[model samples]
Target chain A: MYVYNDFDETFVRTRVAQFRGQVERRIDGSLTEDEFKPLRLMNGLYLQLHAYMLRVAVPYGTLNPAQMRQLAMIADRWDKGYGHFTTRQNIQYNWPKLGDVPDMLEALADVGMHAIQTSGNTIRNVTADHFAGAAADEIEDPRAIAELLRQWSTDHPEFQFLPRKFKIAVTGAAADRAVTRAHDIGLVVVRNDAGEVGYQVIVGGGLGRTPMVGKVLRDFVSKADLLPYVEAIVSVYNLLGRRDNKYKARIKITLHENGIETIRDLVEDRFNAIRAGFGGYDQTLLAEIEKSFAPPAFVTKATDGYEAARLANPAFRSWTDTNLSAHKAAGYAIVSISIKKHGATPGDATSDQMRVMAELADRYGHGELRISHEQNVILPHVHQSDLPAVYAALRKADLATANIGLASDIIACPGMDYCALATARSIPIAQQIATRFDELKIEHDVGPLKIKISGCINACGHHHVGHIGILGLDRAGVENYQITLGGDGSEMTTIGERAGPGFSADDIVPAIERLVTGYLDLRRDPSETFLQTYRRLGLAPFKTLLYPSEDKADAA
Target chain B: MPPRFTPKVVTANALLDGDAVWLTEDDHWSPLMSRAELITDEAHADLRLLQAKARASEIAGAYLADARLGADGPEPVHFREAFRTRGPSNYPHGKQVETPPQT
Candidate 1:
């Protein structure tokens, strides 16, 4: 994790003071609601359905134990006893008091964190792969670029008020864990034919109402020119992006209106003009940032204990099979602590659970933790020999669920339950599905499934990329759910195709159960996953199961 | 025949606590839906909304929301408003923490 310098500390302290004064002004009738709305949003405070929600950014999904413990303290003291980890790899306190938000910001800054740039129509938090430096397949650590982008975009004079909110993600691995293809600006590190490491910059990919994959504007941008290159793209967008309509203001819409080639030409022209302005300071800064991410020293440890423990305990073996990922170090493993316990709200963690995770990080994970975009906690450097002990600690806290990629591990946004923008409730739907699936004990049989639910078309749940996507909507003043099939968020990414009419809230869960059970019958075997089967056979079969009346009429 | 506007309540989140509150008949903000004044007439509803909006120090986003007087009191006609009166479905918190779950 990158420690804050005196300059960064001063910068955050100043923002806290500014926001505290702004809050006081609003209280004294000096700043009207209209005037304070943008200011509050700039600090990541949003008035939701029940209370004010505060979103805190965990930069690049990296946090030390002290920061994690401070987050727990904030949750317990200022807000509710728990916080919701979002798909953006950040945490949201759903019941924060408006007056206490300034104090909350001060507490966050005390731990070298802040809520600035977490919201508003500006460059949002820069996300990276949770297993960035620890992954075996990574070309290089992507956090260096992610941090550079974070510093450059934060309070940038020209890009602060973009046409719409911009999102950027970077992934260093061969596998697409960061969902880079779905970001407004996705950076995939690539090694060229000449053995040069550079970024394959993809633009215009987004997942709101209009879901579209990004186009590759550049095949490879060297590290030296990356900052200038990205700035040029944003600059071109700042000039050409639509501001007349909020819905049509994203860069994706810009790319849709003007062809990719023309936009690429504009960006390249701008890049040439402004490349010298960077003055080569970004490269030196990047080198300094890279030094902060040096891998921990490897300690030689025998794996006989791990093998014996796994063989002795079936539950431990199952959890290891489900939640463990390949680590770059021989004796180390990446442990994804499943925050989505069965039938619970997907990403919520109580303050006690937060403290437990912090302790686990300090004891077993070299005092480091990562938050996955899927809303799970990641101990990026857990040793293989310590897996049994970690599993025991997690189980005691009800955080040890052996479901990572299964149907029970669902992604859901805080829908109508908390968000003001949501049209229907998403958490209940996710909870019902997970609970129903767990009761049947066939999730492991279903195997490698992704069910993502979004409350509305905002796609905060990343439903656009789920194998089975459930979108909640308001139909005739009642909650309705629409199903989509064949969406994948990996390198072979595609937007899901909608299956016909929507189902009522009461009918949606059962409808999903039927679809999955039907999938069990239609699959070649348990070995073939949901996406593969959906690809082999089109939506015709699943559609039949989801809307049986339509299939019945066709049969008649 | 002209369509009748449904009964309504002026509702907003409290500026300090951010909890949902409704304007009462006595010009005070009440956290309980039962205490809310249901404005039946359109003109009166607009006036009440304006009055609520003027209380900037007390509220953040004031607007008229659809409601109807039921056997008990003002009942939310839409699910979203009902959810606002209660709390999130996943947890027993907010106003509904004390009130029994509605069937």
Candidate 2:
């Protein structure tokens, strides 16, 4: 909900003009494909399988009503009338033309948005918990720092071109909704014993060909030293990161090659040198940024009425039970609008639905929306008094799905349908799974389960972190799927281990059903969740159901 | 027989006015003979037609000649060269080049 200042406005406008010139040069042959590739990537323009795709950044997944309306307008005017919200909290238009990308950038700039660094080997969008400011258990609002990092990293000359793309995530809540541990750099804001706020900085964690949990470089870095510390870390990676091969170019690989102790010492040495030069500039900037993100004043209203309404309407009660989270303010709750409608594509919202969300955010909640890392929208602050009205509006828009963390609320990437690099279809697989689970009426019985699917090894779907992860691949011109179990994408993050042999695309869904049924039967109590049972028993029991012959031989 | 490579034509969304067209053959883009003449088919008839057009003597001559223009002016010169050369401001055939009067 932060408005662009004159400086911000001028910067984006100038960037758009520069890119337009670059595009013109590319079209006229002044720039070759090799030269133009990096330039286009810097602007978030990608040449996918069939057409060009443009990805626009929604910083820290926060958007005002006006911004959401602008996105709707862009989708209708420029794209195929629908925008795909990504797991990274960005929106991608899959069918943009190459020549019109400059115009698209200009349109975004007009709305105080840009696609800069949304792609390419630079520091990408800084993500945070969707319910950052509104979460009741948050030690501090993560977006304040996230926004500061956004400004500092934007067009940073020194780190603009890295060996590979970098991602950073921050979370202030203990529950770790931001998936902090799975990022190139993760920062968890924590208050120490003296009530002084600092960040617990974690480094070297990422999901891709290699998956490793970030190691803690600093247990506590003071609030003022955050920017300098980050700069030092990035500088170390920039200088020492592998450039010989694209596959091993990430900071994770660098950390792996060089011991963590060595990297930590180098980062600390760099931080000490830069910390003195920072001289409270970040503190002043944070104060100004915090003013823009200040929580709205809430009236002390009676929530007994809301309780009565919930008791009267069973549907409302179910929705409130599943979708609502405790708010920091009394008599308020943070609501997550589920986009996972059964049998529909995941992470896609029609323009009309977007407008409806924009209207609701402006009228009922604080005129703000946050797109979650799970591809859902969060109306961060809504008063208890207005729950009934908001619920009714959402129902009218068909945005009132009661499933939040249930089986049907799956996170999937735009796989073979849109991505050129994808090996098989992910959206249809997620859709079929959701539909099958809905038909079975066993979703609620399955309890909290995260089913993440990636079309390839890119791990864009965060498949490595799902409780039941499905990875799509191509085998001898036929589509095959691999399943992994015991994954967790939370404060306690762990990469799932692959189970037995890969299943053919036809055999995947049945295999998943078999595993779920196995969990149901093997569980000591119905209270045991899928992940709990998987972790307690390991992959052996699930493998028995999935690969019965292999299990028997192993048992022998 | 393998399909031939033909340029695919595309129009700017802003300039299309819902009447523009392009030809795509073998991943290459080229200007169509006429926006109205170009048509889509359920069975990839347009792609076949584009491949045939790329092999036509007249189209091949124009494509080679356009390459001589050296990255400026009309691209993949064909009947649509007039539009690309003169700009859509002077559509339906006009002088290819004109200089403004000295200020």
Candidate 3:
């Protein structure tokens, strides 16, 4: 894991002190709610339905054992003994008193972390592939670039108060685990024909009321010009993006209104102008940041033992098959620990579980842990020989769930339980569906299906991109859910369409069961996943199952 | 009704206790008053005092929107707003009393 430098340490400490002063002023009645609200939001404090929620950024989803331990401590002391890891790889505490927020921020700063820019209309925490350095298919580590962007974007005087929040993601591998395409700016690290490293720049991608797959602005931007190029893009958007309406404020809407080609030309024009000003600074900064992220030296080890253990234990084999990925280094594998336990709340980890993860990261995974966009934790560089020990520790902590990309491994937001904006409960719906699927032992049979839930149209859970998306809404004060099929969150991204009529909170699970059973019945074989089948036959069959009465009524 | 501005009783945090209290009509702040004393009775002296305090506190203050009175009762004002109108601990509302000179 990368250690914080003096500059990084100083920045976070100063921010914490500033926030503490603000909080004291608010308490002393020198600041009004309207005056204090933006300041608190800038530090990622939200006034939710039941209590004040504080979101802490896990930068690039990377944390050292000490940082993880500190998170556990924060959960135990300030929060409700648990933390919810969001899809953006941030951890949110549902309950925290307004007075205690300064203390909470101070505690975070002690561990080189803060909640600054975690919320508000500034550049958000830069996300990257959780398996960045370790993934076999990666051209280079994306976190190095992500970290550079983080340093550049944090409180950048120009971009601080944009029309709306901006999100950026980077991916080093072809698999796109970071969901790069669903961000305001997506950078896919690639090597050109001459073997020089650069980024395939994509712009205008986002998810909300309007979801868009980012359009490629540049085929490749040289590694040296990354920051200046990004600045240019953001600068253009900041100046031109809609301010009249909050709904149409995102860069995507701006790009839509003023054609992508025009935006691209403008970005290029700006990039050309500023490229000279950033001359040697970007290279020097990138080099400095890269030094911080250099991978640890690994001794060659045999994976024969790992294969032997897998053969001996079918459960281990199943887990290895689904939860493990090929590592860049031989004899090492990237292990993804699924936070989505069958019937438990998704993306939540208890204090004990967090401590165990910290311990496991220290023992078997180079003391580095990563929180993935899919709402799971990754032991990035675990030696194959140490797999058993790590798995055993995880099992003890109730963190060893084999379902990683299966149907039961669902991504859901906090929903009405915590969010005042939410219309219905998403967590419970996801829990019931996961539990039902587990009971049926049909998750594996269903194959890799992404079932994402969002409480409302905000799309915090990214329901728009799920293979089987469920959106929770309130109809006359009753919780109702709407289903969408044939969605995907990948290079081939497509927004899912509404299946049919909405189902009551009670009827939701049954409706889902009906849809899944329908998929199972209609599938050519078990090899055909829900998404594959849905894509092959379109949404007709699934829609038929969801709205059978409607079909019958139409027929009659 | 063209968005009638009701006679609202606003409260603010006490410098010592951080409790919401009704601002009394005699330019004095009363500590720990009930929601009924803050609102509902337009003719009540306590409610009138609260209203006066609320107006004065508007210089630089935050209203706690989430804090509301119980059902079938008068609306409660925030505690923070009260303290802003009246000064801090070193300065008390009654002790630092300045009677306006007759014009």
Candidate 4:
């Protein structure tokens, strides 16, 4: 909910105007596709397989009611009647016309949002935990730091032409919902032994064709030194990162080739050189940004009505049990409205659905909303007394799926369906899996599973971190899916290991069903989740479940 | 011995709308793959692709895709090209919106 100031507003308007001229020039044949391609990508426009895709950044995954409503309006007026909320907490309009994109961007700027830095080699949108301000275990709200980074990274001259696209994530809480370890740079707000609040700086983690858990660059850097410290890291990466091959261009490969100690030494040298120049200016800006994120006033309310509703409605109870999270404020709950309804495309919300969520946020959620990296809409500060009302509105809108961490709640990329880079269709696979699981009615019983799918090895879907990861590939001109097990994107980040041969598109759903249903029997108890069980037993059991024919041969 | 030439068609996303379009026998960009000029010869396929790429103002990322001759027109031989011919399976958008019968 960081409101744009005069400078921010003017900057966005200037960029939009610039892009409009560029689009016109491209159409008029003044600028060739080669010249215009990079310019359009910088503005977050890409010509995909079927249409132009515009990725609009939702900075820190935060939106006010007005901004949410404007997004709905934009979706309805232009392109399709819905938008896909990506794993990066940004929204993508898949079918935008090239001529109308300028207008769409202008509309976005009207609500202090833009698609700037959502694509290309420039620093992408800085993401944070969706439950930043509201989580019970949070030490501090990470949005202020995230906002500071956003301002610093947006159009930063020196870092714009880095070797590869860089991603940064910050999390305030002890829990790692932001997938901090899988980003190029991850900052966890922590208190040192001296009781000074600072950040645990992690560098070089990424999850594309080559996945790596970030290395700890610094134990702690005081809040005042964060800007210079991060700048030093990027400055080091900018010079030393691989440029010869695009595949080896990310900072991860740099760290891998040069080792973290060497990178750390260089970063420290750079940090020392630049530390004095900062002059606490970034701290002053952070203080100003913090003012916009002040928590809303909480009202003490009776929970008798909430308790009564729970008793009266089993569906409401079920939803509250799964979709609600513990809020920092007393008598408040963080409501995660599942956008992944059974058989529907994951992360897609229609204009009507968006409006419904906006209205509900206004009525019961303090006019604030959040888009989770898991692709769900969150009402961050709903009072327990208003839970019933929120639930009712969500149910009416078909947003009450009551499946947040269950088997059916899958994360899937646009895949070959829309992406030019995709080798196989991911959305259809996600849909079939969810629909099949729903039909079996074992999602809740299967318990706390994260199934993530990516179209290719780019790992935009974060398939590397799912408990059950499905990667779609083109094996001899046919769609093939490879399954991986034991991946966890938590405090203990682990990359999933592939389980033998791939499954055909027709065989994949049943294959997944066998693996998940097999968990019910393999687990010590229902209390032990999928990740815990997989850890305890290893891939041997799950591998057997995934490839039963091999298990039968072994038995024979 | 050279590999057998696969039948192919020139395809690209339209510059204005970004919808998938194929170069027809008349050298016009048609949204329908059926109207595309199928090239059986490898040299002709490469030449047609180059011609399509030259029309940069009208299209972007023009390339040749594998296809086969059908009763009405050319049919996509690969699933990727087949998806491009209609639209995404998730929704009735894109070419599916234009031609509802196929959807």
lDDT of each: 0.92, 0.80, 0.81, 0.93
- Give one digit per residue, the lDDT tens place, for model 2 in A1-556: 5778898999999999999998777666566555766888898987653346789999999999888998888888877677889999999986576667788888888889999999989999999999989999999999989999999999999989888899999999888999998898999999889999999998888988888888888899988889999999999999999999999999999999998999999998999998889889889989999999888877788778798899999999988988999999988899999999887788888899999999999998889899998999999999988998899999998899888998889999887765657777688788888888888888878888999999899989999999999998887656788998888889999999998678887888888888887789988899999999988898888888998777678799
After superposition, candidate 3 runs with Cα above 4 Å error: B1-103
The candidates, ranked best first by lDDT, are 4, 1, 3, 2
lDDT of 2 at A511: 87
Residue A235, model 2: lDDT of: 94
Q: Check candidate 1 and list the clashing pairs.
A: none
**Cα lDDT of model 3 by residue, A450-511, tens digit:** 99999998999999899989999877646789988888888788889888878998899989
DockQ of 3: 0.05
Candidate 3's TM-score: 0.87
lDDT of 4 by residue, B14-83 (tens): 8998888889998988888988999999988888888888898999989899999999899999999999
Q: TM-scores for all candidates?
A: 0.98, 0.85, 0.87, 0.98
Candidate 2 chain B TM? 0.25
Instruction: Assess each model's interface with DockQ, reporting 2 decimals per model.
Output: 0.83, 0.03, 0.05, 0.88
* Model 2: lDDT to the true structure: 0.80
CAPRI-style docking class of model 3 based on DockQ: incorrect
In model 1, the number of clashes is 0
lDDT of 4 by residue, A1-556 (tens): 6889999999999999999999999999899899999999999999898999999999999998899989999898887889999999999999888999999999999999999999899899999999999999999999999999999999999988999999999999889999999999999999999888999999989999999999899989999999999999999999999899999999999999999999999999999999999998898899999998999998899999999999999999999989999999999999999999999999999999999999999999998999999999999999999999899889999999999999888999999999999989899999999999989999888879999999999988889899999999999999999998889888799999998899999999999999988999999988999899999999898988888788789799
Error of 3 at A226 (Å): 1.2
